[model samples]
Target chain A: MKPVATIEGRAIPLGLKNLDTDVIIPAHWLKTITRDGLGKGAFETLRAEPGNILDDPEYAGAPILIAGDNFGCGSSREHAAWALADLGIAAVIAPSFSDIFSGNAFKNGILTVALPQEAVDRLLEVARDHPVTVDLDSQTVTTPFQDRFAFAIDPFRKHCLSEGLDEIGLTLASSAAIGAFERMEGRPWLVPSASPANVGLNGTIA
Target chain B: MASRPRTLYEKIWDAHVVERREDGTCLLYIDRHLVHEVTSPQAFEGLRVAGRRVRRPELTLAVPDHNVPTTARLGADGTPLPIADPESAAQLAALTRNTAEFGIPYIPATAPAQGIVHVVGPEQGFSLPGATVVCGDSHTAAHGGIGALAFGIGTSEVEHVLATQTLLLAGSKTMEVRVEGDLGPGITAKDLILHIIGRIGTAGGTGHVIEYRGRVFEEMSVEGRLTVCNMSIEGGARAGLIAPDETVFAWLEGRPMAPAGEAWDAALAWWRTLATDPGARFDKSVVIDAAEVEPTVTWGTSPEDVAGIGGHVPDPDSFADPAKQAAAAKSLAYMGLAPGTPLSDIPVENVFIGSCTNSRIEDLRAAAAVLDGRTKAPGVKWAIAVPGSGLVKRQAEAEGLDRIFTAAGFEWREPGCSACLAMNPDKVPAGERCASTSNRNFVGRQGPGARTHLMSPAMAAAAAVTGRLTDVRALMAS
Candidate 1:
């Protein structure tokens, strides 16, 4: 994960609503074991269209994306976030987002800013001609035309994004607490007995 | 001292909280973790790179389903056949090696119990009442039907749970969707959920965990509830819950992984108390009349672009919002549909009666009943039935559902996510329309440029016989 403080660049104004993960990176592109090189497949379908904004040279490698409501609405695949990060997008401004996508984006250090539809619409207009600035420290998205929009994000997520924290490392530090909870719950049935005899019902190998 | 009334979600959250931060995020312990091929490889690699061992390998189960071919897995000599796609084969091999290296219990691709992760979790009793289940796939919410607080996670969170057995989380708001009255004949749980998604657009359930309330859900079978809860993600809810009751307990009692004897009794005692308390308030509420729901199907790409089977393709001009209008027009163009055309008049070249949403035994039986003596229409080139699990496949075979399907010109396939996402060999041809029982109708979900119309299993069977999207009720009457 990379730290994201302030990003200033032209924005890809993909203001389409309900842009799902399937559109972000198709299932065929998901066969790779590694997360690198996904940017080439990011928004593959939309970019296939001639003159699409994602392919437009003006917004190439833009650090910010202005989108419509309900962005990243389906699938919990983090590939959507990885694709965006690989595409050099550090922040996404949408009126709303799917819960899973927001969490996935935060984990990858991609800031998801939830602004009003009017604010997103304004950004979409300004982004066509000018560069936009997203300051995570200030929790605001500003444009060259004096447009400044404040957005709400979970403080914990905001902190992690700005600091580029490794969430797995942070959670591991609380392993003692986790063990204590496990002991206190005292539910043996919750833990399945490890039985190697049950590996495969037919016991065949490919 | 009396504590405030708590919703089922609140009770589960409070019970699982190990430590709470001042910012309100908690280190919540996860009870069960389900891993599949596509999402777990990267997470396991991360663990290997970091020299991390799975904290609770016993609590995790790995099964390869997404990229596994649904066709024959074994050859004439009873040896497992190789997967043709190199990328898919490599991905599956990675899972096999990672699970073994990490000491996680894995069900091999040739295992009889190996299936879709969501289906395998409940079928094996790995997902139980009052438990927190996490999977790398979005359809993991289907396990919530058994009273688990389950939701999908990304690979990063997957690695987090594998390493620490807990998640850093914020509480979600509770929303109650109360569906009252008796559902009309031919109106299945799939229709009810499709109707719910149609009524409340995809974003309606965002930022909330929806608890399905009222007689409609209470009377539904456990399998039906799973189908309803399975699509909670499609409605933008991370998870959907139906209070655990005798129905869920009965369904789970004799499963291979369920507790038995004294442990079962103790588990039942605790599970009975996992319901929402009286006077508990929800952050949001949606009341629906069950009678209002019809045999529904998607008319366009998005799940919300749905209508009753009798309805017609809506004109984009009918939409009030310009964004919605443009989306509808684009969907129509992609789907090759004309405005004002009756939904039933739309011809389908393919029929797919399987997915996490509708691939269980009950779903197979529903499709079988509709195809009892009928044959596929001449114009319908392909139709296949993929069971949710090997156990489900065996049960259906025992009940002769496979024969009924094959007799009706539908192929009886192995248990896997075949043609659902088209990650495997099963894919609808480009430019072809399929009446599918799967959850999503998104563009290219089945295959690149493939058009999907979501419906119930019986509706899919009806489409197979009619070569068009026909109401199952009408087929039953004929």
Candidate 2:
């Protein structure tokens, strides 16, 4: 995951509030053990209707999405975030998001920008036609018509997004402390015990 | 005290900080990571791709729940687990394989410890006071009843925790929701939570860790408390918790996972100190009178779209908030309900008496008390009672709760998250209405176009016998 500073592209304006993870990716498609090829099932139910923006040729490969309040409301499934990423959505501008969904998106390198409802209303309108720009460095979303809407993300999330640090990378950054703790055996579970990998049922190394 | 006293959430959070970032974020340690079949496959795949092993395999537990059918038949050894649904079979198989490869402990379908992740976790005492717990399923908040700061995580976070045994999380604001007064008879924790969510609206607890306080929660059983905390997510809260108390400690005592003997004494001493300090500040506070909360039910899609059983369905146009008004209108349309209909008039074709929210032994006992000598209405196409886990199933059968339900014409089945969602064959068919104890009444939550009315187990049992959303409070009065 590389640092993402700005996403400038056609934005799919799905301004539907309370858009749950079930709608993002239904339960039926969750059977597959892999995260690949999920965008096809993303918004499956909503995409069944004619004239949905997800299938609209003009928004194909769009890198931005404008959503309404309470986006990603149901389920702790990361598949919702994966589907959005697979659809080439690099940034989501919404008034609010479910906390679990927000964390998932951050880990997967998708920028989630929280803006005021009025700002989102404007972005939803601007997203209908003109290209939009979300600049993480400035924490502002701009429209082709010069509409500049400032946004906010947790400063830590901003750092993680800009630094391309997932949880593992972040944890490994503190390897010295981890090593010290392991040496101290402060936590029993963290102790490195012999799991005896590649051993045989005959109770001896083969 | 020059400094402000911290809430229980802050106490637990500060205790778990492995590293604090310059950007107001921190790497908080997770004590336990619970995983389920539906949401963990991709995370395990991520670990395999990276050649990573679970950081602390002993601290992680995996189980299959969401996709297991309640009607599954016991099969001979070497035969499949009698799960005819291919999607479900695949998910369970994936979980089994992932746990095996990662050296993580798993409770398979036939295992005595197997059940819904939330129920089995607390039942096994893996959820303890003053610890941070995370699971891939949203109902993981149920673990909070045992006094842990618990919440659900996405698969990415699951992978993160699996690889590192920790998560980088931003701090959450604290909100204290203190309910005073004794609840009326038959007014369970479900009613109290529904009343609170109805008053606060769905997003009321957003960006906050809500601590359940006051007398109402203090008097609740662990199961009752879990039923309430389980739906904290539905009310848009990231996490919900109760301070560890004597009752919680007693429940955890002698369980398979709790500290023992001298260790238990030390743990209990530490847990007692985890309660909110006197004069602790909260970002927000709410007071609910237990007397006002009746047998509550959802008349629309959202859990917050609730009303007392004796109340009428609200007209969407009457809402002051435009967003709520729009959502209500849509909910009403999708639920095939109309404004001003007496909630009790809504007929139910199916009755589901399970889910992580209300599938504990007490919930079964409550429903059984209601259906003790009754039979299902002729109009009830089906009524089912699915316990929370295999252990729960065994316990219920031992107590004859299964017999009571079966005699009342309800199907008593194996443990799983049966009919909570449409992942398995248990579903409320299209265009049919169901009275469910499960959390969430979102459109098509049970199945495609299936209407769900969230209620208590007793209310669902009442619906099974009456074929309508009858008021359990009224039945008690009669």
Candidate 3:
């Protein structure tokens, strides 16, 4: 994970609603054992269109994306976030986001800013000509035209994003607490023995 | 002092809290972790790179499904054959090695237990009442049908759970979808969920855990409940839960991974209490009349772009919202649907009756019943029925459901996520329309340039026999 603070650049104005993970990166591109080189496949379908903004030279390598409501609405594919990162997008401005996609984006250090549709519409307009700025420290998206929009993000996620903290490392530090909870619950059935004997010949219970 | 009345979600969240931060996020404990080939390989690599061991290997189960072929996986000598696609084969192999390296129990691709991660979780009883289940795939919500708090996660979260057996998360707001009245005859859970999605658009359930309450859900079979919950993600809900009752307990009894004897009794006692309290409140509530739901199908790419089977294709200009109008126009163009054309008149070249959403034994039987004594229409070039799991396959075969489908001109195939996302070889050709039982109808979800119309298994079977989007009820009447 990389620390994300402030990003300033031209924004790709893909103001299409309900842009799902399939449009971000198709399932055919998911066969890779690794996460690198997904940029080539990012927006593979949409970019196929001759005039698609994702392929526009003006918005190439844009650090921000202005999208419509319900962005990343389907599939819990983290590849969507990875593909955006690969395409050099650091922040996405949408009216709303799918819960799973928002979480996945935060984990990958990509900032998701939820603004009103009005604000998103304005950004989509200004982004076509000028560079936009997103500052995590200020929790705002601003345009050179003196347009500023404030957003709210979970404080814990904010902390992780600014610090680029390893979430697994943070959770591991609370090992004692997790162990205690398990002991207190005392539900052995929750973690049944996975010995080979328990697995029947047909993979059912013996 | 009186205790606060808590909903089932609140109770589950409270019980699983390992520690809470001042910012309101908690280190939530995970009980079961299901892993499949596509989304898990990188997570395992991350663990290996960090020198991390699985905190509780016994609590995790791995299987390969997304990229596995529905065709035969063995040769005449009875040894497993190589996967046709190298990338897919490598992905599955990575899972096999990673699970073994981490001491996690993995059902081999050729094993009888191998299937979609969501289906295998409940079928093997790895998902149980009041347990917190996490999987790398979004359809993991299907396990919530059995009373587990389950949702999908990305690779990073998958690694987090594998290494720590806990997640850093905040509590989700609760939403109650209460359906009253008896569902009309011939209406299935799939239709009910599609209707719900239509009423409350795709993003309706965002940031909330929806609890399906009312007689409609309580009386639905466990398999049916799973079908409903499986598409919660399609509605933008991370998970959808149905309160467990005697139905779930009876369905879970004697399963391979379920508790036995005294443990079962202890589990049952706890499970019975895992329901919303009488005075509990929800952040949001939607009351629906079961009679209002009709056998529905999605006319556009989005799940919410749905109507009753008797309706016509909607004109985008009719949409009041400009954004929606644009979306509708795009969907219409991609789906090649003309406004004012009756939905029933839409022709389908292919029919697929399997996915994590609708590939269980019950779903297979429903489709088989519709296909019995009926053959595929001449225009329906291809039709296949892929069972959810090997167990489901064997069960269907024993009941002669496989024969019914094969005799009806639909190929009876092995279990895997065949044609669901077209990750395997069973892809609908580009520019072809398919009546599919899969959850999503997103553009190119079936294959590049492939158009999908989402429906129930019986409806898909009807489309196969008629070579068009025919209502299952009408077919049943005939």
Q: What is the TM-score of each candidate against the true structure?
A: 0.98, 0.95, 0.98
Rank by lDDT, descending? 3, 1, 2
Model 1: per-residue Cα lDDT at residue B305:
90
lDDT, each prediction: 0.89, 0.84, 0.90
Top-DockQ structure, candidate number: 3
Candidate 2 vs candidate 3: the TM-score winner is: 3
In terms of lDDT, which candidate is stronger, 2 or 3? 3
Candidate 2 lDDT, B1-478, residue by residue in tens: 2357989899888877777878768888888888889888988888888788787887777778888877754675544455787777888889888888888777777666678989988887677788789999887888888888899998888888898888888889888888988898888888889889998777788888899999888888999989888988987888889887999988888766666666677677788888899999999998888889989999988788889999999999999979778888988988988899999999999999999999999999999989998999999998999999877888999998888999999998888888998888888899999999999887668988899999999999989989999988666666
State how far residue A56 of model 1 sits from its true place (Å). Answer: 0.8
Error (Å) of candidate 2 at residue B406 is 0.7
Residue pairs in collision within model 2? B115-B389
lDDT by residue for model 3 over A1-206, one digit each (tens)? 78989999999988999999988999999999998889899989998999988888998789999899999988888999999999888999999999889999999999999999999999999999999999999999999989999999999999889999988888888889888887775564464642333554334446
* Positional deviation of residue A54's Cα in model 2 after best superposition, in angstroms: 3.4
Pairwise DockQ winner, candidates 2 and 3: 3
lDDT of 3 by residue, B1-478 (tens): 1378999988888888889899888889999999899999889999999999999888888888999999998789989999989999999889888887888878888888778888888988888989999998888989989989999999999999999999988889898899999899899999999999998789999999999999988899999999999988888887999999999999988878888877788788888988999999999999889999888999999999999998999999999999999999999999998999999999999999999999999999999889989899999999999999988898999999999999989888878999989788999999999999999999999999999999999999999999999889988887
Docking class of 3: medium
Per-candidate alpha-carbon RMSD to the true structure: 1.8, 3.7, 1.4
Ranking by DockQ: 3, 1, 2
- Write out fnat for all predictions, comma-separated: 0.54, 0.33, 0.52
Restricted to chain B, the TM-score per model reads 0.99, 0.98, 0.99
